[model samples]
Each structure stands twice: as structure tokens, then as C-alpha cells.
Target: MEKDFKEYITPPVMLVVLLLAISLIFVFPVLNMIILGAILAYGIRPIARIIQSKLKFESISIILAMIAVLVPLILLIAYIVSVVSGVLTDFLASNPNFDINAVLTQASVYVPQLSPDNISTTIGDIAKYVANYLVGKIGSIANISLDLFILICSVFYFVKDGDKCYNFIKSFVPDDHIEFFDKTVESVENVLKSIFYGHFLTSVIIGIFGAIGYTLLGYPYGIFLGVITGILQLIPIFGPWPIYWALAINDAFNGNYPRVAVVLLFGFFLSWVDMYIRPAISSHHADIHPLILLVGFLAGPLVYGIVGFIVGPLILGITYVVLDSFRKELTESK
Candidate 1:
């Protein structure tokens, strides 16, 4: 016991602690990018592996997989941002507060850099920064550069060496704690799937349905409205309700009472479907509480910027599962 205490306060350990603190201080700024990259790599790995199976070059496969996954995503998000900015610009001049109908008509959308989707995230506050960044109003090009570099590198490395990384971490675990560790890892995986299904996948499903419904109703930008609804769905607290309600309000103001009723009923259906769909998709997973994810979505951006939308929820989910795992282990022991 004396020897253990002596080692605990030893100079070498103290130095190690000091170095870790210093390293963390340096890492803290770019840490979110690294973390987000790992999260993205989780999805990218399988694609890379499948591509690799067809070709002998692992690096080429990973690159191709990355290009396949990221190029469309980049193009889609770029279009959304470009379209939203154009709408905001054109409408802000006519209506200082910005016209909602203009937004519905002209804007395309969703997610991180972005979101409020992609695990992606935000629409409510997306305008605040996205417009600025997209329009070349941002001051720190170097910071953006660093963030992209770290994100891409981290994704590539994580996809390539994730198993090795896991094994390395596992080596440090005590034998008695091995089972607990494994369970906790499994739980973490479940939590990721839960978020992916509960938020991301649900958002996609809702968006498609919203697009189809809005178009059928003959709204000018029906498809875009559906896309926006899907983004709202990603928000958890808000859903497809806002889009329909907005349209209903617009209809009511224009003396289109019958259409308002129709849209509202459609809105109700959108909200109603969510109840069944979100749970049904997430049923096979960890079933993380909504509060955790909500806090994550709202708070993540504050700490990690837009990427935090997904990161916040995921990190919180991991924490909850770990604690839950610990609780179960402690209970079983008693």
C-alpha cells in the first residue's frame, strides 16, 4: 500500500499527468473535428471494406469509398447552402425580417459545418453562421483549413486502423473488467445506431414523406418544404409540424380555408407518423432518452460548432450507456 501510494505521487506519473493536461489543452480546439471524423468513419468503413474486397489496394478503395460517399454529400449540402443564402439575400431586401414563403419557395437544405440533420444538424441557427461562411464573410481561413485537414486525416486513419486502435485500448483493461468493457462497447454501438435511426434515418423518412405530401398538395415549393420538414425532424423537439402549420397559416391568411384544413390534416398525419416511425426504427437499438439527444443537439454546436449537433448527441449517448453498463455490473455483483 505504501509502495502504491509512493508510485501514485511519483515524479514520473506526475510528469505524465502534466504532459496529458498540456496535450489536451492543445488538442481541445481541433478535438471536435477528430471526434466527428471518427463518427463519420464508422459509416465509411464498411463501404471502404466492400470496395477493397473488389480491389487489392486498400488505400485506393478507401479513397474511392470516401469520394463516393463525400462527393454527393458535398454537392447536396453546397446546393442547400447556396439556395438558402440566395433566398435570404433576395427576401431580406423586400422584408427585413425575411419572408417565410420566400424561404419555402427558394431554399434547399439540412446538417453539420451544418444541421439542426446528418446526426447532421440545424436550421434554427444555421442562418447565423452558414450565410456568413458561405458568403465569404468568415475571417479565419486558416482555422477552416486546419479543421478540414484534421477531419479528413482522422476519418482516413480511423477507417483504416480502428480495429488496431480498439485492441490497443483493450490491452489496458484488467482481466476482471474485460466483460464490463465489452458490454459497454456493445452498448455504445447500440446507442450510435439508436441516434442514427432515431434522428438521422427518421429525418430522411420524414423528409421524403413531407416532400411527397407537400408536392401533392400543390404548394409552389412542395418538395423543398418536405426537405425542410425532414431537417426539422432531425431536430427531435420540432418535426414536420412546422412546415404544414406554416402552409396552413399562409393559406388561412390568403382566405384559402379549405386548403388550410387539408394542410393541417396532413400536418397532423406527419406528426402522428413520427410517433410510430421513430420508435419502430430505433426499437432494435439502445433506446436513448430524448432529453439526452435534445441537449446534445442544442448544446453540441455551442461547444463544437455545427458538427456538435451529431457529436453532442453521440458523446452523451456513449456516456449514458457507459454509466448504465457500470450500474448493471455493480448491481449484478451485489
Candidate 2:
């Protein structure tokens, strides 16, 4: 009886230890990587598959596909990083002796209804009161570098092992449900592909028009601003309007009165394109309501950051299809 008790206890204890070891060694990192890699893979998997089918070369196809996809992304990220870094560096170099109180006092007096007589004295007093209010910039170079490295590594692993992943997931589904699951996943994949491709094409159109309009209007950094505006336009709801409006306001502030009208007109055109064109494109691609797509866009970012834009909508689409299928089945049976 003592031997039997010892044997059972040892097995249970060993099992617990093994489970703990597996959790520490395997579960945590994989879970984190899955979230990261799945998003990257979802975006690029179509292109990779196309390359495989058309090019008929496995390793070369994937490599070329990665280069085609990642090179522009890397370049874009570098450009943004450079621009942000330059801004930060300029700020650091300026080392401004900010007189916050004086500015506030002057600002208050400049307002339409404020007293003029109290302006200088108020400004001086406020300046003296808030002399120590200052902030220093923290450089983001290290963090950006680390993030880029992780993203690249994750993308590589994701592309390499994606098939294995599909098989692993497929293994879990019951035999009868397998086809349904496959079809659902395919539908989700198609939705994601459509959204991405449509958005990309629309952005290109907007970016080109923006570049031309801004350049014609003689705005500084028009091309850069246009590209930025175009990308921002991909965001749901708020979209590109804010950026163009901000640019227009900057022009007004800087006394470029003539260009302000042109800028405003440009923004309006872009907004029009977004309103009219995007919905049509989305409809063509997804066969879903534009309103629902908009909701997906809004919810996607909230749920999954950049990736959520595609993933969230795909999820909603799949669920809609599945529920509709069930509803049809029930009606038929009845």
C-alpha cells in the first residue's frame, strides 16, 4: 500500500513539474509571438502564395516576396524615424529658454475680450511665477531599433512556419467541422486581402493627387506631407482630413494666405474620394456593407493596433457569414 501511494504521488508531482517547465519554456513566448507574427503573416501571406504559384520556386519566391513587401515598409519607417529624429534633435539643440508665464499673459491679453492695460504687468508677473517650467526630450532611437528588429525576426519566422501553423490548427477541428472551418478561414483571408489591397490602391491615388495639388500650390514638403496625409487617410472616421486641415492652419499661421484656399480645396477633394470611392472599392472586394466595414475599421485599431484594421473586420465578416449560414440551415430544416 505504501509503494502504491508513493508511485501515484511521484507521477502527479512529475507531471506538475513538467507542465510548469513547458509553460515557462514554450507557452509564453509563443503566445506573444503568435500575436505579432500572425498579423504580419496575414498581411503578406497572399503575396507569398501568389509568388509560390506563379514563380514556382519555393525559397526564391518567398525571399523575393519578403523583399518586395518589407523593403518599402522598412524604407518608409526609416524616413518617418529620420523625420522624427530630426525634429527631436532640433528641439534638443535649440535648448529654448521658455518664458511660459509671459507667453500666457500675452496670449490672454491678445484674446478679443481681454484687458489691454494689464497685459505687460500680468505677463511679467506670470513669467516670474512660472520660470522653472521646462521639459527635456527623450530620444526614441533605441526603442525604435529594438521594435524593428523584433518585427523583422517575427515576420521571417512567421513566413517560414505558416503552413505548419495551419496544419496544427486544422488538426484540432473535428472531422465534420473541418471543411466549414477551412471555408471560414478562407473567407476571412479573402476579406483581409481585399481590404488591404483596396486601401493601398486608394492611398496611392490620394497620395499622387495630394502631391500634385500641394506642389502646384507651392507648399513646402508637399510630397512628404501628401504621403503622410494619404497614409493617415487609411485610418477610419478621422482619416486624412485632420492632417490636411492642420497643414492648412499652419499655412494660415505662417501667413501663406493664398495657399490656404488651395490646401482646403485639396483636403475636400481627398475627403470626397474617401467618401465615394472607398465604399465602392470595399463593396466590390468584400460584398459587405460599407457601414459595417467602417465599424470594423474603427474597432480594429482599438483591438489590434494597426493589424486590427484588417483582422477585426475579417473576424466580423467570418462571424456574419457563419451565423447567416446557420440561419439558412435552420430555415431549410423547418
Best by lDDT: 1
What is candidate 1's lDDT per residue for 1-334, written digit by digit as tens? 9998887798888999999999999999999999989988888899999999999788999889889988987886786787788777877787787545444434335212322132123453677577777767367778899999999999999999999999999998999999999999899889878887777888888889888988998897666778789888887578888788889999998999999999999888888888888888876898778788789999998988889889999999899989999999999999
- Which pairs clash in the backbone of model 2? none
What lDDT tens digits, residue by residue, belong to model 2 across residues 1-334? 9999777678778898889898888545344345555666666666787898988876666677778887998998788788778877887678677565566667766683344446556777888766633211125556446656666666766776888978998997899777667766766665665676667677878878887877877776677777787788777666678877898899899998877887888789888987777767766656666666778778877866566676667667666766765665567669
Residue-pair clashes per candidate, as listed?
8, 0
Candidate 2 residue runs with Cα over 4 Å from true position: 1-36, 49-57, 84-105, 110-179, 254-258, 290-310
Model number with the top TM-score: 1
**Candidate 1, residue 146: CA error in Å?**
0.2
Which portions of model 1 show Cα errors greater than 4 Å? 1-15, 81-137
